[model samples]
Target chain A: MNYPNGQKKQINQQNKSVKTNNNIFSNRGMSLEEDINTTNTYYLETDIAIIHKKPTPVQIVKVNYPRRSAAMITEGYFKQASTTDYNGLYRHRYIDFEAKETKNKTLFPLANIHDHQIRHMEKIVKHGGISFIIIRFAAYDETYFIPAEKLFPHWHDKLNGGRKSISYEKIKEEGHIIPFHYQARVNYIKIIDRLYFH
Target chain B: MNYPNGQKKQINQQNKSVKTNNNIFSNRGMSLEEDINTTNTYYLETDIAIIHKKPTPVQIVKVNYPRRSAAMITEGYFKQASTTDYNGLYRHRYIDFEAKETKNKTLFPLANIHDHQIRHMEKIVKHGGISFIIIRFAAYDETYFIPAEKLFPHWHDKLNGGRKSISYEKIKEEGHIIPFHYQARVNYIKIIDRLYFH
Candidate 1:
C-alpha cells in the first residue's frame, strides 16, 4: 500500500528466500545505495582495495533523553559535503575520487558536481594525488573512470557557453571503462592498474 | 565573578594569555583541531603538503520549519568518529594519522584512541600508506610523530599486563620530534621529510 505523497514508509523488506519466477522479481528488490554499500563491504572484506563512502554530513542541534542510556536525536538538518564521496589509499598512492550515477544515456550532466568539488579536485591534482570521477550510466550498465585533468577542460568550457554536460561518446573515448563483477560492482582498481600501474 | 563551586573563579585566574608580554602569540588561541586546520591551510597554500580535518559526524533525526526558508535543526546526536582526525596526501604518498593532546607530562595514555581507529590505521599501513600518531604534550609545548609500527606493539602489550601508556621520555627517544613554527603548529612534514624522504 502506498502512503501519502510526502510520507516515507519504513519497511523491513529483507526476506529473500521466496522462489521467484522472473528476473525482475529479484532485480526489483535492491536499491542502488544498498547494492553500492554491499559492494563496498565486499571490497573492504577482501584485501583488494581500501575505499570508503563518507557518511552523510548532518548538523545536529538538539537531543532528548528518553532514558539514562537511550538518548534520542530531536532536531537536525543535512549539511552540504565539502569533499567527494570516496577517498582512500591504494598501491602506495593517494586515491581521491567522486562517484556519480546518471540515468541519462546521452550525456552526464555537469550539474551533478559543485564548484567547491572542482576546486578540491584541482588541489588534489596539484598536490600529485590521483584524482578522478567515476561515472556510472546505470541505464547502459556502463561505468567509466575519467581523470580530473581531462574533466577540467569540460568544466571550464561549460562555464564559457559549451555544453553543460559531457556526452557519452566523449566518456567512451576519454575515460577508462570499469569492469563489473558479482562482488565488485564498480571494480575501479582494475582500471587503476591498467592506467596508472602498467 | 565566581561560579557556584569557585570553578569559574579558578578558571578565570588561569584565562590570562600566557604571552601577555610577547608581541606574537604562536599557534594563536586555537584548539588542537583549529591549529591543525590552520596548518593545513598553510600547507595547501604553499604547496608543501595537503591535509584536512574531517568534519564531525552527527546523526540527525528530525528538523523543524517555522518559516518557509529557515530550517531549524531540532533534534540530533553526535556519532563518535570511527576514523582519525586528519588524513591527506604528501609527495604522491598516502598519509593517514591521528592527533591527540594530553596534559600528562610523564605518559601519553592510549585510552584516547578507540579500537576501530587502530584497526583503520593498520589497514592504512598495510596498503602502503604512511600511518602515524601525532601526540602533543601540551603542558610542555611538545609534539611528536610516532609511526604505527611503533604503536602496534604497545597496543598488544597492553593486553599482556604491560603499561597502557607511552611515556613522553620514551616518545622523545623513539618518535620524531615535530618542529613548530609560528604558522604550522604541528609541523609534521619536516619530520616526515627527515624520516620518509631523506
Candidate 2:
C-alpha cells in the first residue's frame, strides 16, 4: 500500500517479528536491530571499526520524579531522525550508512527511503565520505550493501519522473552481498575494502 | 553546607551569577556552544576537520502541530548525552571532545561534568582517540584545550576524596590556550597539533 504522499512508512513500522504478546520471535536467534548493534559493539572492541548507532531521538514530555533520584519518563514521542542511524571513522575514512531490513522476496521497494535522507547521503558522498545503505532481505536470509554512488543514478531517475525506488533484482546485481560471519556479523567493511579502499 | 543525605553540597551551591530575573549572565558575544558549532562548520567546509556537534538529545513530551509541515515543540526536557558533542576524524586519527563554557573567574569547576562522562572520556583516550575538553572562560573571552590525560588525574583525585575540582589557575598553567582566527574561529586544532600531532 502506498502512503498518500507516495512514500512508504517504515521508520516506526513496528516489526511483526517483535511480537507484542511475549517478545518471542520465530527463533531467528536475535532481532535484526539487536544483531547489528552487537556487531557494532564487537567492531568497537576489536579496534576494527568505530561505528555507533545514534540513539533514537525521542521527544519527552511529562516526567514524574517519585523520589529525588528516580525520574520516570512518563510521556514521550519518537522524533524523525535527520540523518542515518550509524556513522563513525573507519580506517582513517569517514563511514556513514543506514541499515534496513525487508521481508519482500521479490523487488526491494525503493519506497523504504525518505527523500531528505537520500539528499543527506548524497552530501556525505559529495564530500568524499564513504556512504551506502545496508539492506537485509529477511525472507532470503541475505544482506547487501549498495554504494551511494550506484544508488544515486536511480535516485536521479526518480527526480526526472522515473520509478522512485530500486528493485530487488537490481540490488542483487549491483550491490555487494555482505558475507555473514560469526565474528564480523554484518561484515560490511569487507565490501568497503574491495569497493572503496582497493 | 551539607545536603540532607549528609553529602557536602560542595560545588552544588546555587550559581551565584544567576540574576534576580532568573537569567544567567550570558556572554555578550556568541555563546561558547554557538562558537564551537561555527568552528566545526568552518572546519568541515575547509576540509581541515570533520567534527560535528551531536544533536542535543531531547525527550519530546508534546508537540503542537498548529499547521501542516510545521512542528512546534510545546513541551520537552533535555536528556544527558551519552557521548561527547564533537567527534570525527582528523588526519587518520579519531578526535573526540566536549566543549563547556563557564562564567566563574576564580575556578573552572568540575561540578559541571558528570562522573559517567569523565569515565567515557577516559575510555576514548584509552582506545587511542585524541580526547580533550574545550573550556571557554566567557567572562575573560579565553578558551583552553585541556588534554584528557591532564584532566584525568584531577578527576580521580576527587574520587579519592581529595579536591572536587580543578582550579582555573591550574588550567591556565597546564592547558593549551586556543587562539582565535577569523576563519577558524576557535582554532582549537592548533592546540591539538602542538599537543598531539607535532
Q: TM-score winner among the candidates?
A: 1
Error of 2 at A12 (Å): 38
Error of 1 at B27 (Å): 4.2
In order of appearance, the predictions have TM-scores of 0.82, 0.68
State the lDDT at A68 in candidate 1: 65
Tens-digit lDDT track for model 1 on B1-198?
A: 223686555655665643441214444355677677878889988878878777776665556787776676666667888778778888878888999988898999999888889988999999899999988887766778999989988887886889999988889988998776668867888888888888
DockQ values, each candidate: 0.44, 0.14
RMSD of 2: 12.3
Candidate 1 lDDT (Cα, whole model)?
0.78
lDDT of 2 by residue, A42-137 (tens): 887787777777766665656676766545565566677767778776775778888888888876667777786787677677666788999888
Q: How many residue pairs of model 2 clash at the backbone? A: 9
* CA RMSD per model (angstroms): 9.7, 12.3
